[model samples]
Target: MVTAKPSLELVAEVLNGHPRSISRLISRVEARDPECRPALAQIYEHTGRAHLIGITGVPGSGKSTLVRELALAARKTDRTIGIIAIDPSSPFSGGAILGDRIRMNELTGDPGIFIRSMATRGALGGLARASMDAVDLLDAAGFDMILLETVGVGQDEVDIVQAAHTTVVVSAPGLGDDVQAMKAGLLEISDIHVVSKCDRADANKTIIDLKAMLSLGLRMNSTTGWQPPVVRTSAEAKEGIDELLAAIDRHREHLQHSGELAQRRRRTAEMRMLKTAEDILRARFISRDDDIVVDLVERVITRALDPYTAALNLLATLDEGKSDDGGKKRP
Candidate 1:
């Protein structure tokens, strides 16, 4: 029987590109296990070298298939790829419903590719809370490229922009009203647009409509000076995958040349900081002693205290608890 390695040793093994160690670290992160923190802290210094790309779109956009094709195309260039495929959660178990192991089975035997399936777990913005943490682990493990595929929840996918250096939005033909849904929010956040399943005759309509919309709006982030290009891809025919990769490469080059990469990195850091803080506060709020909030809840329930005042009062109790503990926070 083999004993488990310590966290630091596991981090060392992961950095040395041990696949099993990398998977174990990601598992700990997804479980939100406290033991994972030290390894994550060590991993952070080795990150920022990997190119993180986010792929998002509505349901039936063939995102999984497109991702598989993109990975295959990218591997031809000899680049190691790490894929985080976010699937909808199982209502009963809160686990990923469609695992990457099944969806991307063809790529399983490749040594250069690593795919992880994470459940959205009811998280808004189409990503799991632990998704970025998994990305960090992969980045630290020396992967050249990381592809983050969201849960295909349209409009709520804006979070991908905050998490990735480049965001690709996939659009499919004959999605009925889903195309209109893109006009509402997803269109504004895409760095590159892809019309998947272009083998279908109706695909031209989607390509034309997307291009026209791009023309209407500058479709360019003023900072990056990039006009999002629509690339047509047919997984069945294996066409346009190379062009899509080229578009992504061009966007990365533009970001580097225009110095927008540094700015985007800074914004990503700030957003992550704020989001982490919100999570911490929410956890503390939920874990607070029941006795402390019961009175406040009763007061608000009876209209003796306004909800706003009761909320303030609850915060005051937290402050008091902190003071009593010599400024250290309680679990």
Candidate 2:
């Protein structure tokens, strides 16, 4: 006799804060397993309650350190937390190269905090395709706050803006030209700008440059009259972290009062739905005969058909096939 798959009840138990089941559920979601859908459906209702916070910036800006400090500060309020650290993937194993858990050793053994490190797997914006799903799972698992730390890639880090309710862009002194942060499009998406490593000698200069940039209206202003505040923090020294946390709380409050929280959640849902539909379409396209795709590619290579026209033809073929299947199922 074959063993049956775990029921949604078991998954629900996990969502009710079962520690052992959390990682297993996340793995299933990451693998895109069909069996995970029922659990996700039930868990979906419990999401949107957690405060989703995104932390991103250039490499060596001390993002991981700040994330740790932020988590610690949040714990002081007796809030449970979840952390998703997106690390660069190893070329050979496609596993997270940097051990984020090791860096967050201080938070270990805390039942209230769940930490997960995901490999980017070459995805743009330094996020895995399953990052959002992981977030939802954590939210359903009853974490009061969720922090998403992106791989420290420059411009592409903007993708986190759509995934989190609050986006924090971190910068530090001695990381080269401070002006580069303004040009990299970080200001536009940031809900809070953190000048990290304030203990450094040039930290004051970095903070001044950030304030100057904000004063110039380079950062996008929220319709709620909320201006993204630039906060200073020395994660290593644990100085100014409370101020940074307060800034995040103020931004959250602003979003709630201005009705922007609902708007942001709606946008996040729209993006996730679109990404799912795109993945389904791509899979359907590739599931057709291999020879057909090979032939199409060969024709394009030999100038027999342009790529745009070929794509249209392929889409048409897929549509016709779907119509044929529907007809067969009728009566």
* TM-score of candidate 1 versus the correct structure, residues matched by position: 0.93
Question: What's the C-alpha lDDT at position 99 in model 1?
Answer: 57
**lDDT at 178, model 1:** 64
Best by lDDT: 1
Q: Show how many residue pairs clash in every candidate, following the order shown.
A: 0, 0
lDDT of candidates 1 onward, in order: 0.85, 0.82
The regions of model 1 sitting more than 4 angstroms off are 1-4, 90-93, 219-223, 327-329
lDDT by residue for model 1 over 1-331, one digit each (tens)?
0136665678888887888888887877776666778879999999999999999999879888888999999999999999999888877887656655565788998989999888877778888888888898899999999999988776656899888999999999999766677887899888999999999999999888888777778734554578888999999998999999999999999889989899889988998889887787766777765676788889999999999999888778777777776745543
Candidate 2 weakest ten by summed lDDT: 1-10
Alpha-carbon runs more than 4 Å astray in model 2? 1-7, 90-95, 181-184, 218-222, 325-331
Please provide, for model 2 over 1-331, each residue's C-alpha lDDT reduced to its tens digit, 9 standing for 90 to 100. 1124463755667677876677777777777777878888878887778999999888878888888999999999999999999888877877666676767999989999999888877677767788998898889889999999998867655789988999999989998884564555777778889999888899999988888877777444634588888888987687988998898889889889989999998899898899778776776666665466778889999999999999887777765776767623111
**Model 1: how far is 64 from its true place, Å?**
0.9
